[model samples]
Target chain A: MSDAERLFESLARAIIDADETAAVQLSETILAKGFDSAKAIERGISVGMEKVGDFFEKSEYFIPDLLDCAAVAERATAILRKGLAKEPVSRGKIVMGTIFGDTHDIGKNIVALFMEAAGYKVLDLGKDVSARRFIDAAVQWKADVLAISTLMTTTRGNIQNVIEQLRLDGKRESFLILIGGRAVTREFAQTIGADGYAENAAETIRLLDKF
Target chain B: MTDISPKERLDRALLGKPTDRAPVVCPGGMMNAAIVDVMNKTGHTLPEAHHDADKMSDLAFDVYENTGFENFGIPFCMTVEAEALGSAVDFGSLECEPKIQKEIFPSVHDAVYLPIGAIEKTLRAGSVIQAIHMLSAKHLDVPVIGSLTGPISAAASLIDPMTFLKQLRREKETSHKVIDYVVNQLISYAKLMADNGAAVISIADPTATGEILGPKFFDEYAVCYLNKITDAIHEIGVPVIIHICGDVRMVKPQLQKLHGDVLSVDAFVELKQLKTELGEMRTMGNLSTYLLEFGKADEIFNQAKHLTTKGIDVLAPACGLSTSTPSENIAAFTTAVKEG
Candidate 1:
């Protein structure tokens, strides 16, 4: 096998193991070996993250491992993104945040990572995000979809607030609103007037594709 | 006998005094549709009223009045402490229970140091204290229980579970420091609740239980800190009741060793085993939320009878009832307790 191919294989293994240091070292080696930046991200980082996600779903990998793998993938993605941006961007853009009064963001972050791996340009608005901010970002970025998440039953009302605010402001139909979280059921999402709801991070791409 | 208050019945049971019958206690874990309907009939709604101290206390009283549960507690949700710590909470609609917004703490590093005065200014904490105050004032005849999240759960709220767990694995000192801060804040809150007349401080530490963390992790992370909080609360003269959600069969003995006076079990566990393992210490719960949410009145009655037959000192739903649970199920369980 070529050196680039070997480096990609080693980086992928490091990501599955959640060995961030080893991942960084392997990523640097791949870059030194003149590996294509986009290919490294897709074949090295994203491939490994997919395996991690699968392991997590199967219960072989828990939350801690997922976080570490995500971190490594993020680090590698950042380096490749910088190099690849000189070329044309291929993915569509998405604006994501947790609804107001809902500070939980891990699920959203994981979803964001999955979206990025699936080739979506994610603009994360962070947590405790107000409805206005979500709408503003969606409008400003002309994002195809605005994804909002809330883990608490108490803060789920904020989803309605976002939808109502957008409707009141006459921007209701401008961007699709995809909502998902522990407290957010498909029925609840529909009742709150959300455009879509993904069951988990892995299903996010398919849900977003519906719009 | 008709005039005997639910509080009085519970007190008699706690004291091992013979009653006209076995006192039925809902134990403030699950709230089926029947309970919500009864609560709404008594003029309480979700979210808005759940956070309003007077509204919650009134609702707690209604649980006793309508269902004949031996005792009731206020602010029926668990996120009060985390919400006070600045974590965003989703107060679900009519069909859902409130939950913490998980996206707020994207990483463990996002867990900012809460200021010394932050706890005092938190909306949820202030409301909870108010609920405790109102319950204390209104229910002098019954034991008023105040619930709080444990340190690990609070840490989970500050950040994601994965991030928090990762921190425990990689940054032990930082994790312990964060836990220490959380424990101190919780102790102060527990003391305030106790001072306001909470007869029992219910420590709801679901995240610390065996379902999520094994016995070893529980020993290192949950038991020691919980013991500290329990001991502190005990020093103030109020009993502690530890409620660990999910299957806690493994940690039953360790929980018994904690400073808590009562150990509440979840429905996933068998009452017969808990009764044999727990021996003499007071215990409550084992009713399934799914059963209460979807089962017929006969199912609730049978479950209650089954739990009573196993000798649970207190009867309650195994865990907090899903917000959508049917009221008849709760009423059936409570009614069975009264009849028993």
Candidate 2:
């Protein structure tokens, strides 16, 4: 294998192993060698994240494992982002947040990080975001999809509230609506007029492909 | 079934002893059942009762009296322990529960050890204690469960959760020190609750679950700290009900090591299956709060009946209740358990 291929393989393995130091070291090595950092990210770190997503789907890697890997991937991204920021290649655009009255954002944050890793440009409006803000961000960003997440059941109604607001503004058809969190279910998505549902961070990225 | 008091029924069921019927109650923190319509109808509400002992007890009573829950769970919001530990809080509006606006320490390693009794002396913590005292004194025949945010959860709240969790691996010693400090504070608070007449102590450790922490760390951290709190509560002659969020299957082996009086699992694990797996250790909950919130009244009742037949020792919402869950549905859930 080529030296560049070897470096990329090691970087991907470091991410899967949740080795932040190794990821950072490999990223610096790639950049120092004048290798394409964006290529390194997409071929190296992103490949590892695909494995993380698969582990999640298979229930082999849970939230804690994802968190560790996410932190590792983030360190590598910090090193690689200069090139990535300029090129700005993205598969899809999504605006995501937890609904109003819900400050718990771990799930939302995980999805956002993984979505970014998966080549999606995500505009993250953090926790306790209002329905108006969700609709407004989606429209402003010209997002292909809007993803809403909440751990609490009380703010769950706010998902429907956002949908209703979209309909009121005649923008309901403009963006695909995806909803998930601890409290959300497939039935809930149907009940609230959401276009699709996701159970976790991996599924969120998977469902976004349909949009 | 012979008529028995709510206290007798739950207490008996808790000890893995025979009971007239399985007690269906809602413990606070993550399992809070104080919905909006219940508050609207009764004129007893949270974000207000959350700070006053009288109002807190009044609402706790209202939930039991109106909703048919046998026990009273107090201090409706989850941010109390975090607030007591020096996190800035935004006590939410009438329709919302409080949330931690910011942590006291920016990182877990920065966790400074507070003087003992520090948590108990906080204003809202005092209010929670007094409310339990009032409720237990008034309704001597009903179970009064004083709920506390579990130790890891309290620790996570005081430091940024993501950072705190990373520290558990990266900075293991400091993380344990922080969790130990939180556990000490919880024991002090729990001791005060027992002294003040909290019949049972319920812990909702949503952050300290196998699904979130993974199995090995869950055994090392979640089970270790929860066992400390549970052992202390047991020393005070009070039964403990501990709720761990998400599927418990990952940590099922470690769960057997847990010493809490009752182990509460979320809806993903059927109590029947848990019964077959764990055998006779007394379990509570598995009712899907989503089902309670979105399902028809009959649907909830049927689910409750199914759980009843599964022989769940105590009936409760799988996780916290949504404020928007209709009173009629909750009423049906608790009512079905009682009637069936």
TM-score (0 to 1) for chain A, all models? 0.86, 0.92
- What's the true lDDT of residue A129 in model 1? 95
Model 1, B305-325: lDDT tens digits are: 777787776777777666555
Q: What are the runs in model 2 whose C-alpha is more than 4 Å off?
A: A82-85, A186-195, A207-211, B1-3
**Regions of candidate 1 where Cα sits further than 4 Å from its true position:** A50-60, A82-211, B1-23, B26-35, B44-54, B87-127, B130-134, B159-166, B206-219, B247-259, B274-283, B323-326
What does DockQ give for each predicted structure?
Answer: 0.18, 0.50
Best by TM-score: 2
Expressed as tens digits, the lDDT of each residue in A1-211 for candidate 2 is: 8899899999999999999888988998898888888889888988999889889778788676788898899889889876554865789899999998888887788899899888899999999899999999999999999999987776788889999999999999999999999878999999989999999877777787666
TM-score of chain B of each: 0.89, 0.98
In angstroms, give how far residue B163 of model 1 lies from its true place: 4.8
Residue-wise C-alpha lDDT for candidate 1, range A1-211, written one tens digit per residue:
8877778878788888878788888877776666787878878887887787777665466455566677778887776666564753646789999888766676788789778876688999998899889988999999988899996665788889989999999999888889898778999888988888887776777676565
Model 2 Cα shift for residue B142 (angstroms):
1.6
Residue B244, model 1: lDDT of 80
Number of clashing pairs, model 1? Answer: 29
Q: What's the chain B TM-score of candidate 1? A: 0.89
Model 2 chain B, poorest ten-residue lDDT window?
B272-281
